[model samples]
Target: MNIRLLAFSFLISASCFSQGEPFRRVNEFYLKGDTRVIGNTILSEHATKVYVRPKGLNDRTEMVYIDIDADSETFSSSNASLDIPEGAKIKYAGLYWAATYPGAKGKQKTRGNRIVYDVKNKRDRPFDLVKLSFPGSNGYTQVQGEVIYDGMRDEIIELKNAAPYVCYSDITDLLVSKNAASGSFTLANVIALEGYMYGGSSAGWMLYLIYEDETEPLQYFTGYHGFSFIKPENTQELSFKNFRAVERGDVKTSVTLAALEGDLILHGDGVSVFKEDTEEYIPLKSRVRYANNFFNSSITINDQKYTDRIPANLNTLGFDLAQVQIPNKNNEVISNDAKQVKLQFKTESDRLFVFFSAFQTEISTDYYQRVVVEGKPDTIIKPAQEKIAEEIQQKETTSQENVQLYGKDGERIVNSRNAALAEMLKVPALRVPGMNSGYYVVNHVFSKRNYALKWKEKMQLKGFSPVRFVNPANNYHYIYLDYSKDPDALYERLLEYRKLKDLKEAWILKVNLD
Candidate 1:
């Protein structure tokens, strides 16, 4: 019996190690370059004054780097040769700049100027491009051969304090493969001076190049669930590890989730990684927090710290999925990537609800199994639903008796449609002693006099005393709910009636009150 047990344990261990795992690596390199004014350039032609700081100024020490007041200004910089690591090649590169001050709050009506860049390799000619123009760049003219900056911001002041906003331009595929070396670019800021407008930069320009030695195979797993009537003080645990990844080799895995955020009175929320058989929670290797807004809260995975509250209204929940890996002693995720994972939340109030639609990502060798929460015939909201049902049933019964119209003193009167038409036709015409005049406003206008009289009667039945004004020029009648001899007082009454009656097309009718 002991020998048989030992053999069975070896087989389990062998099966666990047989799963295939993919490898992925990411590297970031910064190339901080020098920014200096290139004299004798076209940018200086239309200048009231051009101010370009000396090259290689420390960003912290320098308050302002480049300040230009010219109608057009240009500055040039050369990026140094990249110190490529052995066996690693560049996948992509991004050029970045920071605009520190002279925000929209400044005297200038606009924030950043129409800027363009001239980027090129060491040997080839330059490519003229605009910086981050979106929705289409037809409004802005672009020079030939230059790649426009994809990342542009109209507002420079993003925070409460006057902080600099950074801009990035992707030049990865623009560069000629991994074999290509040095490159250079020139920044041209075209400022239209209405009354001496100038802009400043807070920091120098830099380049971030991402390199990868080898590409890893990617896999995706997705699932969706919507929890309803999740009262406060209830814990909701959703498991997303229904699917399995490739069962061969050890691999590193990270999960990404996108969910709709609804009203939830939850005090705490988090995710957990567990070993299915033993049911042990896996520890995280590290935790990174990002800058996010109220709706887009930052998320922490390891310690399970999450930011942002579930809003009462329907809002797009932009919580960053915390990236975590399989637990190991060396802090490397070498375990089988098929381990089960769950996202959990805790609520202290009885009015909390949480919802998730799906989780999708490109991890190497993953599988997905959908978990559905079946609808209960006896739902928690059956009471509220029953109440609405009762109200609707009552309305249907009362609708029959409601057919009888009543007058102001609660006496049964003729129904509106037939009675209104009959009474209106009895009146010969509108009686105005003098030239019809007053500060009058009309909710509706009609060319036919009979139509106007009928609408007036309809308004009376609804507890409003509407008057009709005749415009002899167009032979039209204007229906007015209120009027005054005092123009100001008439406007005040018109405003009040508009709100009380929910009038959208109401407007003051100008007429000669002779």
Candidate 2:
């Protein structure tokens, strides 16, 4: 990839213009092959012609022309003029250039001698370097556009053909950092000699302003310059958007502020926080290595302050979920201020990698698994209820003169006791193969035949068609409530029995018949 690096800087050169002529001087930079460096030359010193080598002749030549008419007042271009707003801070200022000289046809030929210009006639000619005056020389500057040739290209201009276009340059950081931010400058040109036949032609240039507009909403500038990771060597305000705070126990793990998210895990004895932004202190026991040193910084948005309260690392940032407010007149964060929220946080951690991800805040928690066994039926649970029913039956059979044996009322009383005992018995289903239709719940399983038969007779008395299945492996008999072809109908009946008849432990069992 051909990464086009922008070359821009302020030129504080001595004047070359007349008393009232609007003059602009530019500091020069050259692209030697893939490398870019400041040229020892300036724009105003060349007498006749500015020269630059074409790519066809020398792969090591690229020349930069910067407009350095530094002033604090209003600046204008051919199309636009901007008055320096009151208290407005310039964030980025740039110049745009269009390469019209290396016409579409000029690019097809790789011949080195394609661009050649004769500087013999230096008066009233396009290639001649002459000075001119404009209306805005003193006050409201008329930022007219002019054209010239690349100094590096001129060195090999006779032997090479230049590139077809010159891309735009962004010198915002350089200009802003120096505090020599230029508000206005006359536009100039960087031209290449196409040849004797299609002599001297250059690229078109324009001026544009990128300033901190306080009246407008906040606009976020993203890039290496916009947001940066907090380090001891470097410190800057990081803009945040929709935010949330999450706490697990005494240690606050995560705080979602704006578009940034980071995790906090405190390990050592204790952490003390001293916020430079708010001048607040959190008591500490001792400081750990990575915890105490890294990410212990703060940023103030609005009236609220957020600092690294607990020891943690910033793992991720930049997943905008909600709008946050911009505090100052020159807004640091660019977003809607409608749902503005003030957040104060002091976080700390040992190992931290601050970045941006789609998932804002994620909690990593440990999970557990266990084996669960459903208990057996109460018929199996309470053996005493069955024993009591059997004892009553034995007493009725032995006492011939008892009213329980002779009278219809006595029979009804015995039947009611048997029904109550049957209701108490719970039938758990055992899965069986080939019983695809439907099968009943087996209330009890017995090792002996007599006990199974007795329960089967009791189930029959309880209005259920009981079935017996013998398990060959265990030599035990399984007593089921019924065997039905329709599983759904049997399941419905089972539900009703479980609800109304107190057969709560009842379950459907499938049986296989070969």
lDDT of 1: 0.32
For candidate 1, the TM-score is 0.24
Residues 1-514 of candidate 2 have per-residue lDDT tens digits of 0101111111111121111112232312111111001111111112122232111111112212222334323121111123455555655444434332332222223358654333232222132221211223443312223332222233334212322222334555544554543233333333322222132222223333345544632222211111112222222122222222111111111121222111112222112333222233333211211333222121222223322211110111111111112121211111111112122212332111122111111111110011012232211112323443455457557755554433655443442433333442333344454445345555678899767766655554344545676766577887766446765545545555565243567665655521
Per-prediction TM-score: 0.24, 0.20
- Residue 204, model 1: Cα distance from true site in angstroms: 5.9
- lDDT of predicted model 2: 0.29
Task: Show model 1 residue runs off by greater than 4 Å.
Answer: 1-91, 103-166, 177-335, 338-362, 366-514
- The TM-score, computed over Cα atoms with residue i paired to residue i, of candidate 2 is 0.20
Give candidate 2 regions above 4 Å deviation. 1-80, 83-87, 96-185, 194-202, 222-514
Q: Candidate 1's residue-wise lDDT over 235-298, tens digit each?
A: 4444543333333333434433321122112223333344442344443235442111111222
